[model samples]
Target: MTIAHILHRVADYDAWRKVYDSVGDMQKDGGVTQESVHRMVDDPDNLLVIHHFDTMESARAFFGRSDLRDAMERGGVQGEPRVELFE
Candidate 1:
């Protein structure tokens, strides 16, 4: 299994969350098996998302999707998200 740790900031957490919640099918379609969401204590807009996938290839493919980028932009993601992978 592979785990992806993604950290990014949003212009508004509430607004971004509404968009995030609307993309529930994206995760499943990307082969994500598990997920978790967290917010920074010092900066509420800073968010962390952990996603588990069956393989690194699947995770990488998901991360590289243009639709995901568009969704993030539409969701009010402030800047590029930092992503790390774990096995």
Candidate 2:
């Protein structure tokens, strides 16, 4: 399995959560097997996101999608997210 670890700040956590919840089908189709969301202890708007994928390629493809970018914008993501991968 491949795991994607992501960190980013959002303008509003509630807005980001709404967008996150709305992308269930998209995530599944993009080969995401599972995901988790968390907020930073010191900064409420900061997010710690983890996604499990079948392969590293799938994770890369998913993150490269324009729809994902659009969703991030809609979710009020403030700046570029930091993404790392592991197996």
For each candidate, give its TM-score against the true structure: 0.96, 0.97
Worst 10 residues of 2 by lDDT: 35-44
For residue 54, model 1's alpha carbon misses the true position, in angstroms, by 0.6
Each candidate's root-mean-square deviation in Å? 0.7, 0.6
- Across 1-87, the per-residue lDDT of candidate 1 in tens digits comes to 999999999999999998888887998998889998899999999999999999999999999988889889998998689999999
Q: What's the lDDT for residue 43 in model 1? A: 96
Model 1 pairs in collision: none
Which residues of candidate 1, in runs, are more than 4 Å off?
A: none
Winning candidate number (lDDT):
2
1-87: candidate 2 lDDT, tens digit per residue = 999999999999998999999999999999999999999999999999999999999999999999999999999999899999999
Per-model C-alpha lDDT, please?
0.92, 0.95
Q: TM-score for model 2?
A: 0.97
